[model samples]
Target: MREFDVQLLTDAVRRMAAQSNQILSPDVYAGLVRARESEDGLTAQSILDDILRNADLAAGKAMPICQDTGMALVFLQVGRDIHFQGDPYEAIQEGVRQAYEENYLRKSIVKDPLRRINTGDNTPAMIYTELIAGNQVKVSFAAKGFGSENMSQLAMLKPADGVEGVKRFILKAAREAGPNACPPIVIGVGIGGNFDKSALLAKQALMRPLDVRNCDPFYAALEDELLEQVNNSGIGPMGLGGRTSALAVSIEVLPTHIAGLPVAVNINCHATRHAEEVL
Candidate 1:
């Protein structure tokens, strides 16, 4: 067995949280650049340009790309042979706390859903862990802002509804989100699984690089189709109206009961910020 110190995890998470907020990941940055180049509408092009500039400025100055620093989300792939020195969850939370406090990232997490009191240090990161065969621990961190997150949708459709139903629902969600979720968004789609699992899959999908496609041929084709349909909505950048409404659509799928077809859409803004580290 390989032994690992909790402090190592803590420090890694802290650095990820801080760095992710300040830098737009390369895939996302590249997507934005492509959007800016392809956008036909002058206004939409201008908006895309501004977004690129904002990303550049944030990276150069070590500042958050958006004011809404977002809730801390940590995805961990733990090796079966690895042993942690302390409670991994607590270590992750500590990293979030330190990052938020030291980096001056906005404190957006609240203690309770209805009570509405700030958590102060962005503690208790939403952590998800999966055990794998290797000896290294892989961490994927995303600072998920609510403007886009609030617009996400989940639906349980009849298996009879099939692909058509899924397509319609996704388009409807994008149309409804229009200006609200921020245009030129990255769409993370989850198909199959139960209701909650579908949602989790959708959220996880967003962490994937924009350039990558689902391994399944069917899902990969669906992603391409959905991207075309969403951009055709002409919602544009910041919802001003153009052909670049969405930068990319990523879909993830899992087996589900025959009676149900659960689908979730997790919308992420142009500043889809995330970082990863393997140790």
Candidate 2:
């Protein structure tokens, strides 16, 4: 088996945590550029322009893109043939703690759900690990701001509800999110998994590059169709009204039991900050 040091994971996560907050990933930036060009309304076009300027300013100034620097998320895809030398989970958390403290990003995490006490350092990152083949490990990090996060929703639909029901629910979500999600949003959708996994899949979908489509042709079409419908909702940039309510809609799906169909929607604002590293 190949052995890897946990420190590598720590350092990668730390760098991504800080970098993602300050810069928009290339795919996301490209999507915004395209959105700005496609918008016909002057209000929507101007809003998209401002959004692009903000991204540029954030990177040039070496500052966080949005005031809500977001909760740190670390996703690990580890190979079955590899082993970690130290505490990988703890290392990930430490990476988040150090990045937030050193970079002066907002520490929004709470130690307790009910009591809501500040964690102070943003420790206990939301980490997800998946084991696959090969000897390499992939680390993906995202700074998930809660403005659009709070607009997300989940539903357990019957198999009988079918695709149309799914489309309706998704469109309704974009409609209701409106300006609240900070329009020109990126939509991540999870379908056909168990309740919790579906939600996790939706969150992970946001990490997919905006330029990439699902490998499955059907789901890829669904993603395209959903993105079009959402933009047609007339939410526009910053919801003032126009043709670009969402930049992209990414759909991630998994096989599911015959009895259940779980769907989740995770909305991300225009910033859509994410980064990835392979080791």
Candidate 3:
């Protein structure tokens, strides 16, 4: 087994937190450019252009794309062939706590739900772990802001809802989210899984490259169909009204119980801040 240093994980998370706040991935930038060209309405085109400009400024200045730096959400896949020398969660939390304080990232998380006191540091990140085959650790950081996270939803539909049901639920969720989750969103649809799996998959879906396609042709077609329908809603950029309601729609599926279909929809705004590392 390979022995890995916990400090390596801590340092990686720190740098990733800084980088993710400033850089908009190339895939996301290209999607906006392509959308701007195809946008029929002048207002929509202008909105896309402004977004691109903002992205450039943010990166050039090395500033966060949005004021809400977001609560750190880290996903880890640890290989069974490797051994962590210390408590993995403590290492990650320490890294996040330091990153928030040192980087001047917003401390948006609250310790008490009812009292609503600031946590001072964005500690206690929502961490998820999985055991995989290799000797490496893969970590993905998603700074999920409250506006979009609050808009996430889950539904336990009758098995008969099938694909059509999923389409309808997604459309409704996006429609209700109108302008709140930040328009021109990247929609993550998780289907056929249990409630928790569906939610996890929905969050995981956001990690995909903005322009990549599902390896399965069937899922690819579904994504295309969903994208077309979502854009047709005319939610536009910032919800002002246009053909660019959503930048992309991704669907992740898993086998489910025969009795029910659980679908979760997670939305991330134009500032889809995420970064990944392998150690």
Candidate 4:
């Protein structure tokens, strides 16, 4: 078995957290640029320009892209062949703590939902771990802000509801989210699975590169269709009015019970901050 130091994992997360906050993912940045160029409405185009400039300035000066650096969400895919020298999970938390502390990223996490006590260091990252075949462990990290998160939704449809039903719910969700979700949003959808798994899949889908489509032709086609409908939403850049309501729509799916069709939509604004590392 290959032995690994949990500290190494911690360091990686810390670096990723600090860096991701400043540098928008390349794919997402490109999508924003394209949106700016295609927009004809002067107001919409101007908004896109400001967004681009903010992104560029953030990266140049090493500043958080948005004041809300957000709660850290970490996903780990580990190989069974590897053995950790320490608790990898705690190490991940430490990474988040150090990142927030050192980089001055806002500590947005709370100790309790009701009590609303601040965590101070942003410890106890939301972590998910899975086992795979190789020795390497892959980490996926996202800094999820609440503006779009608050607007996300899930609908457990009847199996008979079918594709048309799915489309209706999705469109409705986007329309309702409207300006609240921060327009020119990126939507991550998870179809099938149980309710909880569906939500997790949607969150995972957000990490996918905007330029890549779902590999399955079926889902890819659905993605394109949903994207068009959302863009046609007239929500525009910051929800003023334009053809750039959403930057992209990505879908991920898994088989589910014959009676159930659970779908979750995880929406993110133009700045869908995320990063990944394999170690």
State the lDDT of candidate 1 residue by residue for 103-136, as single tens digits. Answer: 8899998899999899899877999999999799
For candidate 4, write residues 241-269 as lDDT tens digits.
99899988999999999899999999998
The TM-score, computed over Cα atoms with residue i paired to residue i, of candidate 3 is 0.97
- In TM-score terms, candidate 2 sits at 0.97
Instruction: State TM-scores per candidate.
Output: 0.98, 0.97, 0.97, 0.99
Error of 1 at 3 (Å): 0.9
Q: Which ten residues in a row have the lowest lDDT in candidate 4?
A: 174-183
Which window of 10 residues has the lowest lDDT sum in candidate 1?
32-41
Model 1: lDDT equals 0.92
lDDT of 2 by residue, 31-59 (tens): 88998889888898888888999999999
Per-residue C-alpha lDDT of model 3 across residues 1-279, encoded as one tens digit per residue: 999888888887888888888778788888888878888888888888888898899889888788899989999999999888998888888888888888778889889889998889888888999999989999999888878888889999998988889889999999988899887899998887798999999988988888887889999999999999999899998898998889889888899999989999999988888899998
lDDT, candidates in the order shown: 0.92, 0.91, 0.88, 0.92
In Å, residue 224's CA in model 1 sits off its true spot by 0.4
Error of 2 at 175 (Å): 1.2
